[model samples]
Target: MRVFQLGLLSALALASVPAQADHHQEASSQQAEHLDAGRWVTLGTRAGPVTSATRSQPANLLVAGDQNILVDVGDGTAGQLAHLGIQTAGIDAVFISHLHWDHTGGLAAILGLRAQTNAPPRLKIYGPPGTAELVSGLLASMVPGATAGYGVPGAPRADIQQMTEVVELRDNASVELAGMTVTVRNNTHYSFAADSDLARRFESLSFRFDLPGRSIVYTGDTGPSAAVEDLAKGADLLVAEMMDVDDTIAMVRRNNPNMPPQVAAGMERHLREHHLLPKDVGELAARAKVGAVVVTHFAGREVGDPAHLEYLREIATNYDGPVVIADDLDVF
Candidate 1:
């Protein structure tokens, strides 16, 4: 596994450059004009399962009035929620995009913590077709913790089954939760695996939240998708995932110089076909005519100043509206 270790090291080394120090604070209080009620706070902005020192895994919290909706409960989502002073019991619902570890890792943690705190009897979770199975597995895995907590003083004694409500969804499904009409559309995240067994089992979803006087679309780790474009049309905010093509190529090369050409080609194909390039995100936002776009779910090298500007410039070529490069805990 030397190659894997080297790849991780290379990613960390490239991410360690001081140039990227500003990615964590780029939107620090300077752009408050876009901030309003129906708030959207990005809890973790990093892509994939690999956590970054500057950002947590992919999680976003949408707070509107008395409702709190969590989108994509990635690893450390519960911790980030606690860090933001949001009560674990206050989470109204959770919308998961896919079954990827990076997106669903913190589900058990959130549920367990909520149970431990005696927040609520049931956690409402909505996701794609396999969501029930995934949540069941997570709950089963947490049996030890749940059992151990039973003997503790004032601890919650509910079983995982009694504490979670998993709602499985399909493409074009619409549901009302927390006073918002949420529409789910199938994105191209899993299209690359069309021939695989997993393809038949699960799906990836993008969410559009129609809240009072405001609309937000979270493109949960998708490529350029026409369905997503239609769902996000004219949205007040589009929280989209973006990738740096060149940075990813360079990172792969740096980490796997000896990798076979075919393997490298395959990796590049996946990156290009499954993730939204900087320009693609711009084009999507422009086509959707979104009011503003918040770039998130970073899928490449660290987002430094120079790289951020380059990305913004590329996006500006197509999307003229506001574009904010979000960091962890940044709200809009």
Candidate 2:
């Protein structure tokens, strides 16, 4: 029942340009020392594929006992890490909840940067069945850069394949990762019929991380899902995505005024069924009985808009636990 917001000091220090750069380097070193203590940092909180003026895309960093794991590598994730005084090469592993472009857009940057730097301890990417193919394609794209080797004549070419390892996870899969036990459940983001080939091929997953002294469940992007609730049950923290259905639909219509009415209607249905509204989030939190909730992956409201507070109010109606509407860089 306690609530706190972190990264205030970092935010203040980052406001100054020259001073911030120096401080960031110092902080990065300091952060490395305490990473084994375990914490969750919301690297990017904005929802969907479109960029925002105030928020970055959907990404999070999980620091679990000497492991730096990226929960989702959305676009701008590398930049978000840089802003927090962390380097892309520092990420040891990544857990992708789904294969949506918005969730996996930054994989190229993470892979490319790690390859360019020739960092040791090859990165491990854990995701759904198609993840290997996704990483394979990204690795193929890096061949030219690896061959160039910064224009150094006779220098050994970087082996991009050696720099990354992909582990594809399926529904109800569990694995040990860097002293943490990671489990995943298939969620309702995609409504493919069970027992169908499409269902077997594609899945949207919710991940539960059981770390030393803490348990966290991340609902990547899902509708109201009993599987997600079961995955999150009794967890220490539930980092869930929340959507403002009406506002999001409005934003979509505004952006595509020429879109057909039927198309818009279909989109609305998808948003309603495939995403969690504020109240849905509250109910899930309540049902899961998580100790605390940190809401990220926000959509449908402008940054600094008062209307955003309505989400908190709606969530409060069902859940009495500590709930935080997180911003980029917020740690919990």
Measured by lDDT, the strongest candidate is: 2
lDDT string for model 2 (17-90, tens) is: 12144545756755545444367788889898457888889999887766679999899999888876678888
Candidate 1 local lDDT, residue 291: 79
Lowest lDDT sum, 10 consecutive residues, model 1, at 1-10
- Model 1 has an lDDT value of 0.77
Q: Give the runs in model 1 whose Cα sits over 4 Å from its true position.
A: 1-37, 150-156, 192-198, 252-266, 300-304
Candidate 1 lDDT, tens digit per residue, 1-332?
A: 00010211212111111122456355435323222225677888888634577888999888755678899988889878876667678898889998888888888788877877877776788999889988888888878887777677786566668888889988899997666788999999877466888777788999998876478899998888999999999887889999786677777688779989999898788677888988999999989988788888985645455666888899999988878778887766
List lDDT for all candidates, in order: 0.77, 0.82
lDDT score for residue 46 of model 1: 85
What TM-score do all the candidates reach, one by one? 0.82, 0.88
Best by TM-score: 2
